[model samples]
Target: MDAPAERLQAADAELQEIDERIAEIGRQNLDAVADAYKEFSAVLDRYEDRATDRDDFQGYIEFREQMAEVLGSIPDDLPHRDAFTEADDELTTGVTSVLKHANFDRARSQLEPAREYAELRSREQDVQGTYRDARSALQKEQSTLETERNELERLKRLGEADLDAPVSLLREPIEAYNDAVAEAFDSFTHAASARAVLDLVAETTAYPLVEYRPPPENLHEYVHESAVGEESLSRLLDLAGYSSSKLDHYVENPQAFRSNVATNQSYLSGLSATPLQVSWPPVASDALGWHMRERIAVVGRFATDEVVALARAVRDLGLRDDYERLRTSATARESLSETDRTRLRAGEIERDLTTHRASLDSVREILATYPPLGRR
Candidate 1:
């Protein structure tokens, strides 16, 4: 009976110790679960705030797009448009900054919860859900903003059309004037006949009569000079008459109308010659119309065929001059003998061919004295 009692007491003591150890583990697990719950709640709050901010940001973006569309349709509403654009930019910056902070805060909160839960060996999927929610909210807001921005850009271009009608009206006469002027000067370089020059002058002046009131006085002088040669100034000459004096005048001063011609012709004789600079006139009117003012409207008209022929003639003359120069250079080069050529090839012809014969002779003598290495 004593042995049995002792055995029962030992069993009871062992059971109590096991129970105490189990209770301690349960307390530790509960504390760990409490900490994890706190972390999870913090992460959830952060994610919720981020979602709210993302929604707010998306609302601002939508508002911006609406404002842009309304303002873009009304060109008269530029001040409003600028305000909306600035507001949109501010909202975007604020939203982006808040979202970044929220993501970091949420991620940090979730990480702590994840670590606690991992230690507890439970609920990893719940923490992963929080991370996914944060990312999804961010992507949704970004996508909405991008789509709205694209729509706003389209509206902005549509707004530009309002200025088109008035601008087009203002530019038409200016363009015509520029084109007429360009044609006038371009024709002047190659005006083969007095009539051709006069036609160009007329076209440049917007087809004004040759004796039209308010004629280009400076141009009149050039034409008269071209028409009358060294003969006496005769107002008695009929308008239709072409005299020997007139022919002689053209022969003497083909470039008398230089100022009336294009500025580039000073460098080349032809209308079709490549200009040294391929620059356009500053105003389209300068290229199209000879006269900018409406009061002085009657401008010139030259024959296109005549202008082209003159251009060809000028080019032919230039080519002829080039050919002559080339011929002269070739003649000079060939005057040198084969010995001279050898010296030139060897870079021994320092002076002219006449002064370099000795060096050439030395080269020949060396070649004769020493047969090629292989032959020897």
Candidate 2:
């Protein structure tokens, strides 16, 4: 090859080498994070499975003690005991630690933009200070004018590099790794287990509906940052659901609590489909206003402007049959009491026929405008 061509080839190879290095770092970090989540999910599944109704009263500790005994010695087929030991430790604290801090992650996302701007601003200030010092030195010696000029240029480049640090080679790889770790934790920390547990509690307690469980602390802060987050599941639960009173109530009602936890286990294990989450049928029309007044209040909590927005979205999507079904069912059953999960109005009521008729019309009109849905 000609000299110039060979030189170009060498430069290309060097650039390729740098690219490969970055790619390798990306792969390594992604794999590390993925493995952490995989292991966490596995450990959680094992604990939940092992802790049966018999051990329900003992809580999660019973499952952990069982794991300790079984994993005490590495099996002959396994590579090493150290892996098992590490996994045991991870099950005990590592997974929980990651989840406990998961909510803070939302808050941290807001802080990131501020953090980057602050760093850039500080770098700008340093550049200005350096330039001033260089100008002062030039006043002290005419011969140093050229030196100061070069120093200012160097400071300019340094400031550029400092402000552009996030895009720098080293910084890029580090940030990629941080993101991989964050996503890793995010995958498992969604409280799939916790959600299931809460559902089970509701089912086992035989309460057709109850307040939802809360997210881990700080996780809920992402809500209210924007209008969308305001309607998020966590925010809704925090706003309208039962408080920390459930924790105390669990002690007073062990059998019921156990049922709740057990039901959660069942729900998590059952299926991937979203189990009828929202309460429906608009509290059976509440013609008397006093009958199922509590149910009416509960429905009011979930049926909000957000629900209206969602109806608009579905209509926009042109899910023609679905939109019709929702509007029609809500219109038809708008004011009927079937507390036994039936359609016919059955319960005793001082039905104000004229007012009840007006109330039914109101339910139909609101549903047509907002759209309503009920699974059953």
lDDT, candidate 2, equals 0.35
RMSDs, each prediction?
Answer: 33.6, 36.5
Q: For residues 136-190, what per-residue lDDT tens digits would candidate 1 score against the true structure?
A: 4434444554555454333333322232233323333334434544565555443
TM agreement with the true structure for every prediction: 0.16, 0.14
**How close to the true structure is residue 286 of candidate 2, measured as C-alpha lDDT?**
25
lDDT winner: 1
Q: By TM-score, how accurate is candidate 1?
A: 0.16
Least accurate stretch of 10 residues (summed lDDT) in model 1?
A: 273-282
lDDT of 2 at 373: 15
Model 2: per-residue lDDT, tens digit, 273-357? 1221222322222221232232233322324444333323322322333433333344334332344123113221222333344
Q: Candidate 1, after superposition: displacement of residue 340 in Å?
A: 76
Q: What value does the lDDT take at residue 345 in candidate 2?
A: 31
